[model samples]
Target: MPDARDKAPLLGLGLVWQQLAVGQRFRSFGRTVTEHDLMGFVALTGMQEPLFVDATHTGALGPRPVPGALTHALIEGLLLRGMVHGTGLALLETHIRPLAPVRVGDTIHAEVEVTAIRPTSTGGRAVVACAVRVRNQRDEAVMDYDVTRLLRGESTP
Candidate 1:
């Protein structure tokens, strides 16, 4: 029989601050945007703009254009599930830019590249900056953003 030390862990854990290096790149699993997602987001957030809530609001973009904020949130959720679940301390800053319209039923994923890493003066924590590009199933760049987050170090402070 195998002992606990010889058994492999089943759950995936987030990376600590020291494990990340500048210029390191990571890819997140894809998530598909469905009509239910749009509806729930619109109702929950009260974003009742015609572009999101109106089914017949047709414009130059498309008939079913979802909000850029929703896309960003979905990407962040993906990252939280895949990369930074427990080791991430807090979200310090985020700068977002929408490049293209994302409609319902489009599967999206994020490509993240670490831009910088700086250790804090007090605790054994570090701030990590990443440049993220969101792409749809068709391989089109739909959004771009830069996010800064605080992550815990390997040892307790």
Candidate 2:
């Protein structure tokens, strides 16, 4: 007979190959340098700096800068919902950075690769790891993050 300790759920792992393999190219939401998205960021942060929302200030920069945090959120959104929503886990870890400016008229796309997956220590959940990125039309990485998620299993009725 199985002991109560031995009745715990078994852990499993899953893998996702290079998203580049899914398609040589992926589409991203379109935006512009002069768009509200940039201004909204400055406003939300309560930043009165002219460089963020002021066109004159941003114009000198060649374009407005998209917050690295927002860019990271975009990358995470693409992976958590757009690409692997069905993975059935909540995010566990996120390490992100923005390397370049994300301006208006730039289309944003993502790249995803599964690194690892397994059950949680409690035996009631699972975990997934993914490499996620959001890039502009030029294919230069504007945002990058490594994400981990917790997967939950079914309960018997």
Winning candidate number (TM-score): 1
Residue 8 error for model 1, in Å?
8.5
- Model 1: which residue pairs collide? none
Q: TM per model? A: 0.91, 0.65
**Whole-model lDDT for model 2 versus the true structure?**
0.58
Each candidate's number of clashing pairs is: 0, 6
Model 1, span 1-157: residue lDDT tens: 8788766754777888898999999999999999999999999999998888888898889889899999999999999887778889999999999999999999999999999999999789999999999999999999999999998888833
User: Model 1 residue 97 lDDT?
Assistant: 98
Taken over the whole model, the C-alpha lDDT of each candidate is 0.92, 0.58
Report residue 148 deviation for candidate 2 (angstroms).
1.4
- In TM-score terms, candidate 2 sits at 0.65
**Which one is best on lDDT?**
1
| lDDT for each residue of candidate 2 in 11-117, tens digit (9 for 90 to 100) | 43222222223223333343333467666766787865666666566354466665666566555555444444554545678787666777656777776665665
